[model samples]
Target: MSDQSSDAVPAQWSAPTAPGGDPIEKASGENFPVALRLLPPRIREDLRALYRYARHVDDLGDEWAGDRLSALDRIEADVRGLYEERREPTDPVVAALASTIARRRLPADPLLRLIEANRWDQQVTRYETFDDLLAYCRLSANPVGELVLHIFGRATPERIALSDRVCTALQLLEHWQDVAEDYRRGRVYLPQEDLRRFGVAEEDLARPTATSQLRALIAFETRRAEAWLDAGAALVAGLSGRARLAVSGYIAGGRAAAAALRRSDYDPLSRVPKPTSRQIASAWIRSVIRGWG
Candidate 1:
């Protein structure tokens, strides 16, 4: 862990001048506040700036439902320019992100990986196995955890491993929650291998309610996510003070979400279960105490 802010370019990038340049509008409410509010003021600002940039990349992947490839190319170009600190082209998210990149020394690999995942979404709709879905999670999920590690000054090999577990678990939980919506988009995050193993057909996922096989598959995935949460719980112990609390919040959120899914009997088709505020509060408190202990 090194704080290399002083070794980089000055953090003086300008804001975009265009009207209505906010990027938070591009993300669902759930994606925007992963660690933004719980952080100190300056760190929260930096995290929001990074999140806005990531959200912009995601929007380019998703919003242009008809011409995703072209949109992704443009977004990629903008991201490259931001990384290079070329100010000639001005975009709101890029402007904010350029400063964040210079100040935080955040690498370009994670950002590019996220864009690539979105590109994959544009063309690849079916995952043949759990490994394939995990590959998708590498692109779609792992970067956020890497960025969080960067923010905490804790980008160790061990911490990154824990972060990956947490991120992948969260991504899987989200897929479980958005089963119907993903199906509506002509995509399926459920691996074909598990589907077959549990005797669930792709067509069954489209139905309004889960068949017994579907319930079995969902339960299996829930168990896997729980395992990830447990494996990644060490990330909280590895940190201290506010950094510890932040990591705990992330772990607790995933656990609470999984608990909600369990409460629903892993019935992804009938309804998507989400953690209630009470559950979030309870999980947060428990995680904090656990970290302390």
Candidate 2:
């Protein structure tokens, strides 16, 4: 959607180096870190490549100094070059993605969708409904789960449907956790309709601590998010070997995060709620034993 032509782009945009830091290191902040060390080396590396590409795309959308829309357009072009045009991507992240695409025979649509989500971020600051928020999750969060399925050779249509529920739940939990932060960034992930239903105003999100109404709204959303996560628990039972463990870890991490939010009485405006290692470990064990009861 950027009006700038390819010719107008700066030279650095051609093959942008990673701005800084290890993209993999960011896993610590995620609901579940992909590319866990316990997985086989090849799977770990492939997932890392995917994570790096995703992180780079997110950074360009969130933190890039130049035209964010133009930057996102360039990343999409790089992905298309690797897939549609069979051209080598100049950007290292896309280059890594190229290898994953070839090895897994992955589709370009999901990758393109992720880029599209970032583009949407530039223009859309508020969602009208919970459905609209889920629509955004389909573009931003679901693709990572799909890509992981392809890497593990488990991407059936049914499994993908299940994964979407899990991914959307994770995305919602993240939105709940970062409500204040998102407000500071001039965006609001909470649906406007839900805000009205709970008597919460947009200005309420800017407060240093959540008001009673805001806390009640978050509680309602938390229950909704937990239901979505539970809907995807069957995904763990459908897998075997490391694939099963990995998927279980994702569900466990979501459960742990949800618990942390509840412990905070769902008040994200005061302080961000985070799951401790012990909570995550306990959830993982229960997931393995109970398998989403």
Candidate 3:
């Protein structure tokens, strides 16, 4: 899809000063901070700007309690206006985003895809097959990787393919960890085909401990996520310096998360699996060494 425009700042452009703003927190949070710390000052600032915008868009989709569809529509409009630089955005997130778009020449399609994925969450609740879930990942996950590529100015077709695999694997790992919470959200990330193959029902996901069927299903999905990480690992070789470090961090994060799932024995209802700091550090070291070699 063509971008909205690149001229004319919007009428709403102003500083965002909300105390404890959700978007601000997400931008500064642990997950987005991974690559930011490894970047130069200017690039880090730019990433923070981009992250704030994306975070605001996601929060509008995930955290808004009332009229989520309307909120998402507004976010989409704001995104278009931000790209066009036609509307004055009062929120700091939007303000930062507008500047990043102007400076980086970032495309509008990834942002639009992200907003559309949030819109999908409002209507879609179940995934019937792996392909179905992958379609969702195309929207809900892959744009982040695309944005990362755009920031680094390294968006070749092959790199994008590898990045897609890594990003989708990260998304799947997240889903595996959040099985209980997703169920509470009236969503399930496990493809129905696999669930049927393992003879696991939706109700079985709510149990405190997983049954044999649930364990089997989780193991199956975990292996798929691992395969994605393995396939995408070459993305590190395709980059250098800070960009390489950033991609390595991403790969390490996925591997660490997957290891956490394995350590948890694929139980979904007990608690979400999270990698310890030690595990992440070890993985990062290994990633660096491997990259050097």
Task: Highest lDDT: give the candidate number.
Answer: 2
Q: Write the residue-wise lDDT of candidate 2 on 149-251 in tens digits.
A: 9999999999999999988888889889889888999999999999999999999999989999999999999899999999987898788888888888888
- By descending TM-score, how would the candidates be arranged? 2, 3, 1
Name model 3 segments beyond 4 Å from true: 1-36
C-alpha lDDT of residue 240 in model 1? 83
**What's the TM-score of each model vs. the native?**
0.86, 0.91, 0.87
Model 1 lDDT per residue over 159-231, tens place: 8988888888888888888888889889998998888888987888789888888888888898897788688
Per-residue C-alpha lDDT of model 3 across residues 1-293, encoded as one tens digit per residue: 01223233234433332246433224311222243355687776677676666666666677665566665666667778876767775445565677777777788898889888888888899999999999999898888887888888888889999999988888898898889988988989899888898899999888888998898888889899989989998888889877787778777878888888889998868887877656766787787877631
Where model 2 places Cα greater than 4 Å from the true spot, the runs are 1-22, 25-29, 33-35
**Candidate with more favorable, higher TM-score: 1 or 2:** 2
Model 3, global lDDT: 0.75
